[model samples]
Target: MIKHHPSETLLAQYCSAQLPASLSVAVSIHVDMCPVCQAKVAQLEAENAKEVFSESQLSSSTVKNSHDTEEVDFGTDLLNLITADPSIDEVYEVEPVTIQVNEHNYELPRALTRISHGRFTQVGKLARSRVAIDDGPLRSSLLHIGAGGEIPEHTHTGFEVTLLLDGEFSDEEGSYVPGDFIWQDGSHQHTPLTKNGCLCFTVVSSALHFNKGLSKLLNPIGNLIY
Candidate 1:
């Protein structure tokens, strides 16, 4: 019942390997959970391969010969493109990984299991914690919002992407469930609220810029904290 999805352009970029590693990871996790997106990406890859091979410099006879084995070759090429690293499956099978918040342990998404152990910093009175991922210029984090918790109204300094992994949450945009991918930028501002708590994988190019009430005062230090 996932309604929200990454835009088609974003999916195209993902298929072409044009996104940042962090953004790509977020989209990959979403694509894994969403069969619709999965099919869409597969179709895009198929079309891309078709266009690529059509423009090849192979002789007409050579192309005709390859046509006999084109299906198998296309499948192999698509597999390699979608999964650039063969070790990803092995990593998933390594162990069960979880992120601990107080007495509770939440299982992370398969794409995130390996990196859940990074530094986790608690925030606010709610059971929220931010786990920072070192992605060079692109800042990413694991954001856990406790039940009934609400984040202060804020806008982004740059682009932001949030992929819900567990539970549900809502904002000015709409309610988002697991597998829903939310993309926002500097022009957008909203206070995210969770009724039954949620775990989200998020990536931000820059820090957030608070835009309301007492939270606005944090603007001076938002870049450092976010």
Candidate 2:
């Protein structure tokens, strides 16, 4: 059973394109894992689509005005922008971008560059590459992360999932060793530091929204990673 099914209202909102970017990422993951919730969301979308068609007198029902489809229309229509630029459909399922992130070779606080890291150190080495940025708009032919060594206390403006690759890190949440997966929603905050100079792999949707004060300091670095 899905432990956290987003509220029905939330699922509806997501289907209606009314959720935040980061929370939407988390909710999509939930739908991938939970078929029951997925079905419900799909049904809601179908109903909305049907409503749209019915208003145009395109209903399957031949009876006049027998349909109870609600009228829901927005003021200004948002256009679906699509370009035939041959590259538009170029979806990237690139090889997991790698990171060597060892204590000996690189200096502390260096951002990991995909081109720099050889084909050897794969991205998210510890856990299965579960969460990845597949959103079509994100520029993914190249992805980068800072080897800043220490991640400060932070709260996600969206969902943050980390998979320890070669080293370990710990915070108020718990100690995460290589292979252990950690995920945090928008509501939780924690300060994480590497205990043994670890190499970590992480995926974030939308930037982390730091709390305040100290968070201001973190915003620069944290925003860079996401």
Tens-digit lDDT track of model 1 for 80-139:
655987766653254667767645578877777666445556676244344445678787
Local error of candidate 2 at residue 57 (angstroms): 37
In model 1, which range of ten residues has the least summed lDDT?
Answer: 56-65
For 70-170, candidate 2 gives per-residue lDDT tens digits of 44233111112234255658764435443333223322121222123223223432112223335542311111222434545678776765544444566
Per-residue lDDT of 181 in model 1 = 91
After superposing candidate 2, which stretches have Cα over 4 Å from the reference? 1-99, 102-134, 137-149, 212-225
RMSD vs true structure, all candidates: 6.0, 11.5
Among these predictions, the greatest TM-score belongs to: 1
* Candidate that scores best on lDDT: 1
TM-score of each: 0.79, 0.39
The global C-alpha lDDT for each of the candidates, from Candidate 1 onward, is 0.79, 0.51
Q: Find the 10 residues in a row with the least total lDDT in model 2.
A: 72-81
164 Cα displacement, candidate 1 (Å): 0.7
